[model samples]
Target: MKKYCFGVDVGGTTVKVGLFTVEGQLLDKWEIITRTENNGENILFDICESLEAKLDEKSIDLDEVKGIGIGLPGPVLDDGTVLQCVNLGWGKFNVSEKMSEMFHGIEVKAGNDANVAALGEAWKGGGKNFDDIVMVTLGTGVGGGVILEGKILTGHNGAAGEIGHMHVEDGEELNCNCGGCGCLEQYASATGVVRLANRYIAKNSESTKMTEFGEDITAKDVFDLAKEGDKGAVAVVEQMSTYLGKAMASIATVVNPQAFIIGGGVSKAGQYLIDAIADVYVKYAFPACREAKIALAELGNDAGIYGAAALIV
Candidate 1:
C-alpha cells in the first residue's frame, strides 16, 4: 500500500471523487457532472482528467498516489468487469484494466456500488468496530452488501448481496426490474412503504392521515404518521419493516453478520425504522443470530467515496 489514494464513485448524474490518506482518512472530496452522452465515452476520461486537476491543485504528484478505487452503480465481476450500468450508459468491459491503463499503470480497483458502500460502513461507518456486518441501502429500490471477516462477499456472479431481489412475497405479481416477483425490494424499500400504505387504504377502506397527502404520500409520510399513532400508516410501516426484517433474517442464515447497517433516504426515519425492522427480525432470525443489532448508517452520500477509497487501502 502507498501513502495516498484516489477514490471515485460513478453515478448517473455526477461522479464523486475523494482524496484520502492510506490511513483511511478522507482528506478532500468533490464532484463533477457526468456526461452520459456518446455512450458515456467521456465518463472515464472526465474522471481521469478531474483527478489530474485535483492532484495539480493540491501540489501532489501522481507518483505519490497508490491507486484509484472506483465504485460503479452496476454489477462488477471479480475482474472489475461491468455488466452494464443503465444510469451511466456503461456496458461490458474490464473497468479496472481500462482505468489502470488510463492512469499509466498506477493501479485501479472497482466494485459494485452497493457492495463498496457496505465496505464503507464496515470500515468507518455504522459497522465500524465489527468485523462482520451487512449494509442495506433502502432507496427507490433496495440494495445490499454483505461483509464477513472484513471483506465483501461478491459471490459467484458478483451478485451475492442482492438482498432486495430476495424472494419474500411469493404471491405478488408485480415484476422487479430483475424479472422477479414478490421481491423484498417491492415491499421493503422506500417506494414499498408508500405502495403498502396505498394498498392498505385501498383494500380496507381505512381512513389515514396519509390519504390527505394523496399523490404526495412518501415513505417518510408513512413513518411520520405512524409515529403520530395513525393506524393505517402504522400498519404500512410495520408491513414494510416486517418484510425487511424477514429478509435480513433469511440473509443471516447464510452470512450471519454481527450487525445490519441501514442507509439511504428512507433511513432518515432513524430509530423508528431500525426498531420496527428489528422487532420482526427477532421472530425470523436464527436463535444464535437473533441478537444481531440493526443500526443506521453513519456515512451518507460520502459512503461511496469512503468505500471506494477502502478498495485501495
Candidate 2:
C-alpha cells in the first residue's frame, strides 16, 4: 500500500489542501471557500468534506494516511490552541484537538501560517539549500518565519518570527492593528505601498499617472504606472523598497540568517523590487550580515500547501 499525508493551508478567502507522497511529490490538490462566519466550525466542516471527496476520487484508503498537518493564520499555542486569528474570527480554539476528533484516530498538527510558509520554502523552495533562513511574505500585511539550524524557532510565546510587529520608527506614530505604532508591517506591505501612493497623490497630484485611473488604485497599478515612467509611481516604489530594505537590515542584524527569502503578492514585482530593496539593505546592514542573500520565492501560491506537508514529515 502507498503512504500519504494531508496538508491544509487555511486563509481568509480559501482553504487549500493537498495530498503528498512521503517523498514530497504533491499527488493531488483541492480548494474550498473558507467560511469564517460560523466561528471556524464551518471552515473545519468544509475541510472534512473536501478531504473525503478527494479520498473517494483517488480510491485511497484512510488507513494509508500517516497524519494531517494544517497551517493557520494565527498564533498556535504550544498545545495546539489557535489564539485569535484576526482575519478568521477564531479565538482560543483547540484546532488540533477538534480536528483529531473529527478524523478519529489520525494525528493532527498545526502551526502559524507564516512558520509553515518558511518550512515550505526551506523544504522545497528558495531556502532549500540553507538551514538558516528568514522567510518574509509581503502581502496585505507583512508576515515572517524564521528557521535556525533546520528548526522553526517559535520563541517562548509562539511569536518568535513576528518580525512584522517590530518597531521601525520611534514616536513616528503609524497605527497598526496590533494596537502599536510604527510597526515594520505598516510601512512594508502592499497596503503600505498603496497608502504611500495615495499620500503622494494627495500631495503632488501633478506627478502621478494614477490620476488617470480615477480615485481608487492599488499597489499593482502603481507598479504598472512606474513601468511606464510615472514619476509618482516611481517615488512610491522607491519609498516602499527603502522601508523594506531597512526592515530586512534590522532583521539581519539580529537573526543573521543565511538568506532572506521574499514571498507573497508584492514579491511578484520581481527584480525591479529586489534590486531596489537590495540597494538600501546592503547600505544599512551590518558588514557581516550584508553577505546574506536576498532571493525571490520559487513556489508561489503552492508554498503553504507544500510547507504544511513538510510539518508532518
* Candidate closest to the true structure, highest lDDT: 1
**lDDT at 137, model 2:** 90
Among all windows of 10 consecutive residues in model 2, the one with the lowest summed lDDT is: 166-175
lDDT of 1 by residue, 1-313 (tens): 2679988899989999999999889999999999999889999999999998988999888788999999999999878899998998888999999988987788899999999999988999999988899899999999999988877789888998999999898789778888999999999888888889888877775578888888778998889999999988888888899899988999899888899999998999999999899999999999999988899999999999989998887
The TM-score that candidate 1 achieves is 0.97
Q: Per-residue lDDT for 250-272 in model 2, tens only?
A: 98988899998999888988888
Quality of model 2 by C-alpha lDDT: 0.85
Model 1, residue pairs in steric clash: none
The list of candidate 2 runs beyond 4 A from truth reads 170-174
| Per-prediction TM-score | 0.97, 0.93
